[model samples]
Target: MSFVLGVISALTAPFLVVVGFIVWDNHWNGTAFALNMYNCTMTAIGFLIVSIVVRQFVLEPSTEEEIFTSQKIGGLMVSSTIGILIGDWVWLEGLRLLGSRKIIVVDSLKPFLAVFLGEVFLDERLERGAIIGLILTVLGVALVGLEKEDHNIETETTIECESVGAAGTEVFNEHTVLIEKDNNEQSSTVVVDSYAQQRKNRGKQSTKEFIYGLVMAILNVVLHTFGVLLTKKYGVGMTTFEINLIRFGFAGICMALLSFSLWSISNISSTTTSTTTTMTTMMTTMTMKPAWYLLPDASYSTWRRISFGVVFVSFLQPALTNYAMFQISLALLLTLESIGPLYSLPLSYILQGNRPTFRACIGAILAVIGIIVLSFKGITES
Candidate 1:
């Protein structure tokens, strides 16, 4: 049951991220916010929600590693800030500026880039096959990125979307197609116009913001690469959970503090602490993070959705993943998990009811194959 739950968790994780981002954006749509402020606040809220849940429910202080020493905290803080906060900040910026599919083109470079960075910084050895795998993976993603752009079909029904920015430009090009079917004496026109508005809104961006977004994405790759190396160096043999909790726990508090000063929500009204806050042994840890000050006007329904969503994203998924590992080898679990990016295809189909291009699908398959090769190679060597 737990392993099934973990598989379900893995399958839903990507969908959850895309959906959750949309949900949060709707809640905070009114603000012309700084990118860092918005990113850090959301990061804090998500991390704090996870830390609080895990500490309260899953993790026992006595059973877990108490590896939160001063040096560890400091190093993890760097990872937290650089990897989590800053990486996500630039990522969102790129997402906003370039759109998901386009930014995904940049992100697809991560596997090879990480391998290269690891070799340089961590002195990790790489095989020739691994190098080939990395290159092939990038090439596959590049193929995927070259989605069909020309869809100038004229129909009786016209769909229009008020282009907000560059972000929506990246939607559904992978799945856009003209469908024609014939009955005995009539033809049916099936138009998937869900993102019709987005399709209409493509010609709405300056060249400068486009270039800037790409630069930010590349820089994000670098920051993330270094952050992982730093985490390994400074985290001192801590498990993934320990590393994440300490990093998130500490960074969440700091971001909460920053959020307190960034907005006037704290002084506008102070609701009493959450009823569940006192139920944890990590009371001292909880005090530093502001779980609700950022969303003063959130309705109960919104709060419930947001809280549960964060908990699922941060804790339940990882928790189930860890639980699944007990029943499988670590390498096997990782190799199984590495196919996550391929989920984007079926996910796009399920969520949007649109099929990706044949070329893009083949590219995705190749990329996943490359990842499998790399994964098995690492296991074979180690």
Candidate 2:
């Protein structure tokens, strides 16, 4: 179950993120703070609702008041803010500065970073065979990531994606907030949300832009790796749902502040000259909410879709991943989880009927072999 769930998480989380951003782009025009505020809100509420169900009716509450002690709670809060909130913003920023391809490739390197740190910080060591397995996994994922050479990757007008994992650190990515054109009014607008709903229209990037993107991408990895390590340190004290409650609940509050700050800034300057200002203000004021529409349309059914990202990808996936890490090593778990495209490829073929390229097929096979070797080596080490 743990391994299966890990596989599911590695595949689904990134794509589901696209879901939450659908309403964001249409309504809020992809404000980073809005994404942050919205993601945190939905994330917290989703965990709260599920946690209540699990706690009240499914599982007994932990009598360990120490779980909620100031020290533990504080640690959890700090970790969550650093890992989820700031880290999330950073990766998306990287995406906007760079592009998804380079950012994703860089993100795929995070497991190795975590593994290296695991040894230095936690004295986590891997067997020789495990080391080889990690190399193979990273290579495979890279092959898959770099398989596409197309510069203009405008997907069919509608697409979906919600993901971040491989999680030696979460590969939180970015789409730089730019001034969005308001169709109702001709005035320029800027990105005011906390999330990157989509990659920017691709074009040649200057050296400085490339450098900035690379730095942000690497920084995003470092922060997320830190968060993952923190989880390994503090994750053992509570149930999965309990950990999630603390993690996302704290994130929601912090994200709200960040989002509100940007949101207020954007609105404060709106000139009363254009009727669109009033319309944008009214639209924002009314629509500033977590996507909760129950409609079945792929994009508009925001909450239903976000549930996949939140409940399965964030909540359950991490639990499974943590369990795998406990059984194996953090390095091994990172290697296995990092091959996200391996899992997503087959699902894409199955669901969308998009055939994989021969290149993709080979990459998937290589990653599978690496995963098997990693698992076997870890089991033997144990």
Candidate 3:
């Protein structure tokens, strides 16, 4: 999903450039403001829907004391996500300094940063494979940027998954249990081989979670890319709030449809009160929360965060990221943008805290290398 978003962002870069040109030619600066505002509104709505679903369905009350603890944790989660918004704003600001291509390259390094952050903050350790993978990534990125020609470039999007294992760390919900004891007490003293297998499975699960992150990332990328084209053709006299409002609106509508489907199915099953119906109802309903409800609480401390979230989505991302195309070349922006994954990798691991097996380690390394190679267009040029 991340790779695909990268490609889509790249592919759509030209369209935005043209749009910016057209806007400029016609003196349509106001259009830009419209875009920015629209973008923010839509994104907020989408986020809200997703949040609602998570809170309503995905969560189970963890403990008696958790009601308050959960709110505290929720507060912290919102605070932390503000960091993401700040990171995103910085990313947009940096994009203005760089172009899409370079931004992508830099963003591609996100995994590396994520690893480093994971090590420092999350207690994630890098295996030999990860180190080697990082080297490959750097080499590959250099090669792609310095190279004169593209490699076996394929069209269309593809996604790959890598697991960071136990070394990775992330903030946790107190409600979520780390592990459950097995019924077989005789094997309480686990063997090394079983532990390894468990680690491998855990790593695989992390990969799945990353997929969700990638989905969100890609959607963000595509919307920003499209917004940039619009700005370049028109001009920045307009606010990004409009664009964000529109795009987010579309996203919100799509998510709303999803929510409706879930609700419809839930109501259908709610009519049945058998044990199986009850179980299914619980699972599905819990999972189908309106995404909006996922947002941080409306507490006074969170007001700034909520506002920033709104502005970043509605205005900054659409206008600034697109405006960046004019200042920095698209290639530079892309390079920088590639670093986003690096930012996420280790944190994801820490969040889940699963260890990587030797094989999984090797796979992760190779995958990172592949990602760099894909972003950089291979190492021959470098």
Candidate 4:
């Protein structure tokens, strides 16, 4: 059932994102207003569903890790998303001034960029093949993106899932376990501590969890790519925050009306949290990172500008992407995004489980190779 949901989500996600983007484009005229409205609306709907699910279903506190995850989901997450908007507004403004083509070209290096970020921020080692493959894939994806811009044909779609472990390490379930004794005969106690540290750094979630993480990661990449494309077409003048606000406004009205008419409405009004705020809170809580981490820092200007980046990353990105996929084609976008599996595979192994099987590794390698080939062939920007 979980796998089915994963597959369903993978299949539907890109279409939802593209459709959302298209609607957003129609409504907001490249301003943040459209994105905001869309975000708010979707968030309200999602929140209602989640509320119903939680209210109706099991609500057990499973373990210590789950407890930690829950704590992260609280107010800290919401504040962090607001921070992200502040930074994103600054970054988008820079991108606008810098121009779209350059921004996109820079954007093409996403996988490589992520790897670099991981190396710098988390001290993850960049493997020789991974680096080389990432470069090739980036080059290939760039070529494909360029081709897409020129020819404007739809892209293919695929889905890959990864699982995370408790210690934050990526574990690959597809591979056989390799047991190697330490050559540096350290004390057993120290060795145990080192192993524990390794796990913590890696983030070992469950297999199912790792897969979901991969899905979310792919969604992030796809949506950001679209954001770049949209920015190019509309120019940075479009306030994505406004788009989100409008989206949220409409979403709020709709959710309020619907909940009042059709569902059991909760008086979350006392919380004064909009659906966008709720989602921003939930997503940030899940990840345990500052929302501003996703955006660039611009000095405080208009309150809107200050909050723009955070709301976009935390709210608009998810909303537009969902709309895009909901109305448009999903296959191409998801297939392109599935290249995330390349990143997810190794990370899952290192974090969730041990290394992948020879076949799983080969599958991941081939996926990257295929992306490179596609890039060389060139894909449309749309």
Write model 3 residue lDDT over 202-291, tens digit each, in one string.
Answer: 456555554554444443344333333333333322223332333344444443454567657766766767888788767875655323
- Ordered by TM-score, highest first, the candidates read 2, 1, 4, 3
Question: Taking the candidates one at a time, how many backbone clashes does each contain?
Answer: 1, 30, 126, 103
* Stretches > 4 Å off in candidate 2: 1-32, 52-65, 148-203, 261-310, 322-325, 379-382
**Candidate 1 residues 72-184, lDDT tens each?**
87887997778766776676576566654576577665655656665566555556676665566566656654442211122312111111232222121110111111112
lDDT for residue 101 in candidate 1, whole number 0-100: 55
Q: State each model's CA lDDT, in order.
A: 0.49, 0.56, 0.36, 0.35
Q: How many clashes in candidate 2?
A: 30
Find the candidate with the highest TM-score and give its number: 2
Model 2 agreement with the true structure over 1-382: per-residue lDDT tens digits: 5545544444344444333333233333334454445555665676678767876898766676555577777777877877877787777778667755677678877878877878876777777787777777777777766553221132221112322111101223321122122334321112211122233223456778778888988988888888777766676666566676687778777766655666566557665348887787678756453222111123556545444444444555555555554455567666666655555465545655556667767777777677667765643232
Q: Model 1, stretches more than 4 Å misplaced?
A: 1-66, 145-211, 265-293, 316-341, 380-382
Ranking by lDDT: 2, 1, 3, 4
Q: Candidate 4, which ten residues in sequence have the lowest lDDT sum?
A: 169-178
Question: Candidate 4: lDDT of 318?
Answer: 41
Clash pairs, candidate 1, are 161-197
Candidate with more favorable, higher TM-score: 3 or 4: 4
Q: Show the lowest summed lDDT stretch of 10 residues, model 1.
A: 172-181
Q: Comparing 1 and 4 by lDDT, which wins? A: 1
